[model samples]
Target: MIFFYTARAKFNNENGADILAWTNYIEWSKLTQLTELVSIDTSINEVLVETDRTSEEDWKEIVIDGYHETGFYRTLDHVLKKKILKDLIS
Candidate 1:
Protein backbone atom coordinates (compact mmCIF):
# COMPACT_ATOMS: atom_id res chain seq x y z
CA MET A 1 0.00 0.00 0.00
CA ILE A 2 1.71 3.18 -1.21
CA PHE A 3 0.67 6.69 -0.26
CA PHE A 4 1.58 10.24 -1.29
CA TYR A 5 0.86 13.58 0.35
CA THR A 6 -0.77 16.42 -1.52
CA ALA A 7 -0.57 19.94 -0.16
CA ARG A 8 -3.81 21.86 -0.15
CA ALA A 9 -3.78 25.63 -0.20
CA LYS A 10 -6.44 27.90 1.27
CA PHE A 11 -6.78 31.29 -0.34
CA ASN A 12 -7.31 34.38 1.79
CA ASN A 13 -7.80 36.61 -1.25
CA GLU A 14 -8.54 36.37 -4.94
CA ASN A 15 -5.20 38.01 -5.74
CA GLY A 16 -3.40 34.74 -5.07
CA ALA A 17 -2.89 35.20 -1.33
CA ASP A 18 -2.96 31.74 0.12
CA ILE A 19 -1.49 29.38 2.69
CA LEU A 20 -0.72 25.70 2.76
CA ALA A 21 -3.36 24.50 5.14
CA TRP A 22 -3.00 20.73 5.04
CA THR A 23 -2.03 17.65 3.12
CA ASN A 24 -3.52 14.29 2.31
CA TYR A 25 -2.53 11.06 0.60
CA ILE A 26 -4.12 8.38 -1.53
CA GLU A 27 -3.14 5.08 -3.10
CA TRP A 28 -0.44 5.15 -5.79
CA SER A 29 -2.81 3.86 -8.44
CA LYS A 30 -5.08 6.82 -7.83
CA LEU A 31 -2.36 9.48 -8.28
CA THR A 32 -3.14 9.82 -11.95
CA GLN A 33 -5.88 12.34 -11.28
CA LEU A 34 -3.54 14.90 -9.75
CA THR A 35 -0.53 14.67 -12.08
CA GLU A 36 0.35 13.74 -15.62
CA LEU A 37 2.47 10.64 -15.78
CA VAL A 38 5.51 10.93 -18.05
CA SER A 39 7.32 7.66 -17.78
CA ILE A 40 7.84 4.73 -15.45
CA ASP A 41 10.86 2.52 -15.76
CA THR A 42 10.61 -0.32 -13.30
CA SER A 43 14.09 -1.60 -14.12
CA ILE A 44 15.67 1.54 -12.66
CA ASN A 45 12.94 2.13 -10.10
CA GLU A 46 12.20 5.47 -11.68
CA VAL A 47 8.94 7.24 -12.40
CA LEU A 48 8.66 10.73 -13.85
CA VAL A 49 5.87 13.29 -14.07
CA GLU A 50 5.19 16.34 -16.17
CA THR A 51 5.58 19.64 -14.33
CA ASP A 52 2.27 21.18 -13.34
CA ARG A 53 3.73 24.24 -11.61
CA THR A 54 5.94 27.04 -12.96
CA SER A 55 8.27 26.65 -9.96
CA GLU A 56 9.23 23.22 -11.23
CA GLU A 57 10.55 24.56 -14.54
CA ASP A 58 14.17 24.15 -13.50
CA TRP A 59 13.68 20.46 -12.93
CA LYS A 60 13.60 18.93 -16.40
CA GLU A 61 11.83 16.00 -14.81
CA ILE A 62 10.39 14.92 -11.46
CA VAL A 63 10.04 11.50 -9.94
CA ILE A 64 6.64 11.35 -8.32
CA ASP A 65 6.78 7.72 -7.29
CA GLY A 66 9.20 7.61 -4.41
CA TYR A 67 9.19 7.19 -0.63
CA HIS A 68 11.06 10.53 -0.43
CA GLU A 69 10.96 12.85 -3.42
CA THR A 70 14.11 14.84 -4.23
CA GLY A 71 12.92 18.42 -3.73
CA PHE A 72 10.16 20.27 -1.90
CA TYR A 73 8.17 17.06 -1.74
CA ARG A 74 10.63 15.69 0.79
CA THR A 75 9.95 18.41 3.38
CA LEU A 76 7.89 16.14 5.63
CA ASP A 77 10.14 13.18 5.04
CA HIS A 78 13.16 15.22 6.07
CA VAL A 79 11.53 16.26 9.31
CA LEU A 80 10.53 12.72 10.14
CA LYS A 81 14.02 11.46 9.33
CA LYS A 82 15.60 13.94 11.74
CA LYS A 83 13.35 12.87 14.56
CA ILE A 84 13.90 9.16 14.00
CA LEU A 85 17.64 9.61 13.71
CA LYS A 86 17.80 11.66 16.89
CA ASP A 87 16.03 8.94 18.84
CA LEU A 88 18.15 6.15 17.38
CA ILE A 89 21.45 7.95 18.05
CA SER A 90 20.54 9.29 21.47
Candidate 2:
Protein backbone atom coordinates (compact mmCIF):
# COMPACT_ATOMS: atom_id res chain seq x y z
CA MET A 1 0.00 0.00 0.00
CA ILE A 2 1.10 3.58 -0.65
CA PHE A 3 0.05 6.67 1.14
CA PHE A 4 0.61 10.26 0.09
CA TYR A 5 -0.26 13.27 2.15
CA THR A 6 -2.72 15.73 0.69
CA ALA A 7 -3.43 19.09 2.24
CA ARG A 8 -6.40 21.25 1.50
CA ALA A 9 -7.07 24.78 2.62
CA LYS A 10 -10.24 25.95 4.32
CA PHE A 11 -10.56 29.65 3.76
CA ASN A 12 -12.78 32.12 5.53
CA ASN A 13 -13.90 33.12 2.06
CA GLU A 14 -14.99 30.85 -0.72
CA ASN A 15 -12.08 31.75 -2.96
CA GLY A 16 -9.54 30.49 -0.46
CA ALA A 17 -9.35 33.82 1.21
CA ASP A 18 -7.61 33.93 4.65
CA ILE A 19 -6.83 30.18 4.85
CA LEU A 20 -9.07 29.58 7.83
CA ALA A 21 -8.04 25.97 8.41
CA TRP A 22 -6.06 23.15 6.84
CA THR A 23 -6.92 19.51 6.34
CA ASN A 24 -5.01 16.37 5.44
CA TYR A 25 -5.97 13.72 2.88
CA ILE A 26 -9.60 14.76 2.72
CA GLU A 27 -10.23 12.16 0.08
CA TRP A 28 -8.73 9.77 -2.45
CA SER A 29 -9.16 12.06 -5.42
CA LYS A 30 -5.58 13.33 -5.53
CA LEU A 31 -5.07 10.98 -8.42
CA THR A 32 -7.26 13.29 -10.41
CA GLN A 33 -6.88 16.46 -8.38
CA LEU A 34 -3.18 16.77 -7.57
CA THR A 35 -2.17 16.58 -11.20
CA GLU A 36 -4.19 19.64 -12.06
CA LEU A 37 -2.76 21.68 -9.25
CA VAL A 38 0.81 20.65 -9.94
CA SER A 39 0.68 21.37 -13.65
CA ILE A 40 -0.47 24.90 -12.91
CA ASP A 41 2.92 25.62 -11.35
CA THR A 42 5.75 25.54 -13.89
CA SER A 43 8.62 25.26 -11.46
CA ILE A 44 7.07 22.35 -9.63
CA ASN A 45 7.79 18.76 -10.63
CA GLU A 46 5.35 16.94 -8.35
CA VAL A 47 2.16 17.79 -6.53
CA LEU A 48 2.51 17.14 -2.83
CA VAL A 49 -0.78 17.33 -0.98
CA GLU A 50 0.09 17.12 2.64
CA THR A 51 -1.82 16.11 5.73
CA ASP A 52 -0.37 18.98 7.66
CA ARG A 53 0.61 22.58 6.96
CA THR A 54 4.37 22.12 7.13
CA SER A 55 6.22 21.14 3.98
CA GLU A 56 7.84 18.23 5.80
CA GLU A 57 4.72 16.71 7.27
CA ASP A 58 3.63 13.21 6.23
CA TRP A 59 0.22 11.56 5.80
CA LYS A 60 -1.49 8.15 5.91
CA GLU A 61 -1.03 4.99 3.85
CA ILE A 62 -2.90 4.24 0.64
CA VAL A 63 -2.71 2.39 -2.66
CA ILE A 64 -2.33 5.23 -5.14
CA ASP A 65 -3.32 4.71 -8.75
CA GLY A 66 -0.95 7.19 -10.36
CA TYR A 67 -2.34 6.51 -13.85
CA HIS A 68 -5.12 9.07 -13.99
CA GLU A 69 -2.69 11.95 -14.16
CA THR A 70 -2.09 14.83 -16.51
CA GLY A 71 1.22 16.66 -17.02
CA PHE A 72 3.90 14.46 -15.57
CA TYR A 73 5.55 11.05 -15.58
CA ARG A 74 3.74 8.06 -14.12
CA THR A 75 6.25 5.63 -12.72
CA LEU A 76 4.29 3.94 -10.00
CA ASP A 77 3.41 0.26 -10.44
CA HIS A 78 0.09 0.38 -8.69
CA VAL A 79 -3.32 0.46 -10.36
CA LEU A 80 -3.37 4.24 -10.28
CA LYS A 81 -0.37 4.31 -12.56
CA LYS A 82 -2.45 2.93 -15.42
CA LYS A 83 -4.48 6.13 -15.57
CA ILE A 84 -1.55 8.11 -16.94
CA LEU A 85 -0.36 5.73 -19.64
CA LYS A 86 -2.76 7.23 -22.12
CA ASP A 87 -1.85 10.80 -21.20
CA LEU A 88 1.83 9.96 -21.17
CA ILE A 89 1.93 8.87 -24.78
CA SER A 90 0.47 12.13 -25.88
By lDDT, the best candidate is 1
lDDT tens digits, residue span 1-90, model 2: 633332222222234432222122223334433312323342322233312224221112232356432332222332233334434755
Cα-based lDDT for every prediction: 0.33, 0.30
Per-residue accuracy of model 1 over 1-90 as CA lDDT, tens digit each: 644322222222232422221112224345525322222233212222222446443233333546544423334453344445555777
lDDT of 2 at 28: 37
Residue 16 of model 1, lDDT score? 40
Candidate closest to the true structure, highest TM-score:
1
TM agreement with the true structure for every prediction: 0.19, 0.18
What's the CA RMSD for each of the models? 15.0, 16.1
- Candidate 2: worst 10 consecutive residues by lDDT? 50-59
